[model samples]
Target: MVKGYNYIVNSFFDYLENRSKAVDSLLCVGLDPHIQHLDKPSAAAARDFCLEIVDSCAKYACAFKPNSAFFEVFGAEGISALREVISSIPEDIPVILDAKRGDISSTALAYSNAVFQHLGADAVTYSPYLGSDSVAPFVRRPEKGVFILCKTSNPGSNDVQILESNREQIYLHVARQSLVWSKHNNIGLVVGATDPYALTRVRDIAPNSWILCPGVGVQGASLKDALISGLRKDGMGVLITVSRAISGESDRAAVAAELCDAINRERESRKQNHTVHVTNNIAVDLIETGCVQFGDFTLKSGQQSPFYIDMRRLASFPDVLNRVSKEIVKKVLDLRFNCIAAIPYAGLPIGTAVSLLLNKPLIYPRRETKEYGTKSSIEGVYKSGETAIVLDDLISTGGSKFETINSLQKVGLNINDIVVLIDRQQGGRKLLDSQGYRLHAVYTISELIDEWLAFELIDNNQFILIKNYLSESA
Candidate 1:
């Protein structure tokens, strides 16, 4: 048993991470197998239900959690169905036995053996009330994990969990104590999504510990709140369990994929939102510093715009321009290109700044090839097969950038991506994508304007006026 436990420990975390990537999902499907939810009244029907769910959603799940109470109520047949369901799951994706068994010493030992040895579950949920000794047997293996029920999903959890102890709440004490108990790094907490407030506290208490988050679907827990609070620093390590949410659906696999995508989008949105706020703050400062102007300004396209941003004036503020240049260079360097080229007039200074900062060669692609002095379209010592990232101040309808792309491609420069200070969102992205190029921007005009309005830099009428103009232009 000890030998087998060591093997399970060796593969658990790695298996979880690898399987999650393979499945392209972090949702853990819970197999509770309640009798009424089954198509038929018999235990075989229950077994088939669980089997079908595992078969369908296994490829879209990181783990499968089987709650023991739902199975044990039916006695032997229920237990048999549970065993068959666990055995049917893919070996790489772990199965956590959600048995909230709470006992210390010898009793904990026997339960641990039943869960790990007899049943073949990689992890189990156990009560932490009995202290470290209760969970010691389970952690002795180091590969398997034990999730303590800190602040559960139900409303009744506060009855005992929230009771004050040593001037700290009992739940907080249990949350903090899990760290001391986590000698092997196998400690986790069963934080209910319903109690996002408590879940948040527990997460802070054990940032690196795995959190098995339930109550997302049937329990009506806030998915947004759970994601904001429960995610570990790497944007993962939260096992979201949904039983009826995935299983009850006719298209369970599609539903699982949607949920998985939503979870990842939420994580990504956090990082993106932080960047937008930071960059938007910079844009606001640039405007206040006279680099950008907010008024009726006629753009080069002969269209009236409420705001005008000029990259040339960035030189007026060295401290801000230095930060802006660093940001632009960092983004351009990420492209891993040999050099950078910009559109003639507006993009010259920004492109030169990026090139000098990144220590890369710079080129300015002319509208037409020069009649003399090399008679070249692109003015740079670039060669064929060498890549160049396009730098531009802003994109409007993308016509100018499109012209630059064509001229570069005609002269033998590789341009697969463009870095812009702002995207006008006037159908430029679609055009760029159609030409097999990616347009990475610090902000879209709409995104910047929205930030301006949010920060009260623009009045409601001004905001509405810009929105109306954008609609008319589109």
Candidate 2:
């Protein structure tokens, strides 16, 4: 096995973000299986065609972005074949469902479930024009991922994305506004490699965000130049998508290998590039990740709750983790803690990402430290009496937070503040207040519901049900 490949990659984002490093390549096979490219009209043949390409090029790919339109054209049978095609992909390789779907609230959510749950897609492409309500369902399920259509390599993309709006190009506004929807930090943008202006501007707006660059093959984008403009300072940020260039070749794997090596060489040629500031739209991200849910769920309190909240889903999204860490870094830098600690189970990734982002040390609290390894409840180095901020993904009854906080205090790590992604408002805030600690959160349940109502994601009865439940629970 390859060096990093020996270890388990847990999520779609983790695989795509690290595969380039693991395999030393960034070539992603774009599985656009047009019927014209095949000899038989059989759905099984189409499935076989994609499987062959994957078998040929899977080793060279960081991910596979199969345009849903192609499979969609085949109707029900084609859809079944698409599922088989998706299942055929290796577990460690992320698949992006390139379906630029955009609609409002619950409708968008149904689409979100279709892509992430039913289809089992690791990530999907979406149009952002319907605004936050339309995108929230996708963003809310932040464990899965979304590549918002920012700028494309096609000729007619200028009709809207590039047109001037509010003294700026519409695409920049889209890039800027995306952060608001990326709360769980799982958001990415799609910019065609052929569009130089967009490639440059989007990076400026979302410096730390990943840009999926298409239009590299038959679309005539300069791969070298696109990499130069698009790569993050680490040279690994952008996903360089080369579809036809590799697919049309007689030796598809050979072509992908060559392109992979070329892209790696180009990225290495410019390692000094700086990373960007990342911001997220928490409501959208939380919803996309399935951290926030509507309908009946029984709470640990023995009461039925209308909404279920959990932010552990955030760990699966590398892009969202990066953005959330960047946001947390901004808040924590001012606090100037000597180290960072996280409550185990959910907050581990968020805390680790923040620690790396801040260049500080990290320690995670175990429910009980391993009897085998240092026999201490807390792992990692920390000085006694040193200050550290706590990271957790959500606060419901504050049941988990207090336990972890007490453990941190026992170690002499002074923590008077805790940061979380969501404040469910079901006595979590008051519980912290009673303890003389402040709760900092990216979004509260009230804010999320308002967004849902505004976008008509929930009807009056549904909205009233949620609000009244929270009100009574409070």
Candidate 3:
């Protein structure tokens, strides 16, 4: 069991990083044995049809997730049919039994063993509203994964999940709670691809966890919308489940292959568009027009600086900031951090710009909380146990950043990465590294100087002064 457990964890993470070429989305074919549908074709014929569908989709899916409700209606004979159908599929594909079982702990243990040992499934979906007692038993199995229902894809999901207090959405609250529930277990979310809006919400909560999305094809949800909504900034984050559309087609294999091709094509198109949109025309203009300036400049850190970025001017030039924020978000998309912590004053607006542009929550930590309301040190929608990337206008001595990072850490938030519009490189990088943070700068001080020199933005004497200041500061 230990050896098997190690094997599963190692392989699954590897698969998560280098997704299976066979199945891009874990889009499973739903094979419910309807009595009426099976009547015309004998049980043997129905089994043959199911096997043929599997053989057809073999090249297109990572796993074939089966909905148990279809087979359970048949009693013993139906159960027998399910086993035969399962046996027909190959062993390499991970099989997810979408049997959303919610019962006592002991019963769950038995079910877990039955699903993993007897039936040979890699993962099973489960209900967690009953709390951890029922869910933990299955997760304890190590290799097996238990996907909990966080925000479902149904239109009626809002009936219970949307009510709020203190301006917090109920579903968002659930997403936060699930982090604790998912700890130390291979847990994932069962989100419906049809609910495009909810896709971003759930992703905001569990950015690193894999999502199993249903509601493509037969449900009429656009695959394109799912890709845009479900994808992490880095271009991977979900296992899409498509059941009826693929299984019910006349030429099942051909249809499944087409669906696979469609998903891949949609993903590629979205990736390309996302890249171009991030660094769009307005961004190019900013570089061409000197809106993002470069020269011999003095930084607030009391260090001689070589580069200066006037992101503050973006407020007056609304269109350019909009374009810049859009591009910046594209770079930081899917980084899975909690809130966008904008360095106060200059960074506040850009942070707001990014949060508003992406439609994500915003939080700016104050040197001190307001006199009214919650009096929280951090403003906006921020929760503990979540990671966040600190966004700043520029970095120099890194003193201001260290202060900001310290305040966030006091509130139980993880601050390991810092994103800036410009990197002054005047001991800022070394300072940040000493404090344990890696910097992600849009334009390094060196790059800005080089471009400025090439464009004749600065003369040789001015460039020399800037270079001397940077060297002395370091």
Query: Model 1: residues >4 Å from true position, as ranges?
Result: 1-11, 274-474
Q: Stretches of candidate 3 above 4 Å error?
A: 1-8, 11-19, 22-26, 39-46, 165-170, 182-185, 273-280, 283-474
Index of the highest-TM-score prediction: 1
Provide backbone clash counts, one per model: 1, 25, 4
Instruction: Report the C-alpha lDDT of model 3 over 1-474, residue by residue, as the tens digit.
Output: 222222444434243333354346545566655556554535564566567778788777766776666666656665566677776666556667888887777898898887777766667888777777887777775556777876777789888767885688766776666667644547777878776667766776777777788888777887765665676655576777887787777787787777777777877764664455323364345555465655546656464444555666667767777766776787688577867889887788778899887777777888786788887888767778788789987787788798888888888889889888778787788888997898877776665554443334554344445655666766
- What TM-score fits each model? 0.59, 0.56, 0.56
CA lDDT, candidate 2, residue 375: 88
Ten residues in a row with the worst lDDT in model 1? 1-10
Q: What overall lDDT goes with each candidate model?
A: 0.79, 0.78, 0.69
Candidate 2 per-residue lDDT over residues 1-474, each given as its tens digit: 212356654434565677667788777789988788877877777888888899999999988988787787788988898888888888777788989999997789899898977787888999988887888888775557888999988899999888998799888898998877866667888998886556866876787787889988898888975775576656666888988787778899889988987897776544422221112655556667786788799987789988887667777878777777777777666575788788887888888898887788999888866878568999889989898888887788776788888889998889888888667787888888998988888777877775554443554346556766777878
Steric clash pairs (candidate 3): 23-61, 23-62, 233-334, 338-387
Best by lDDT: 1
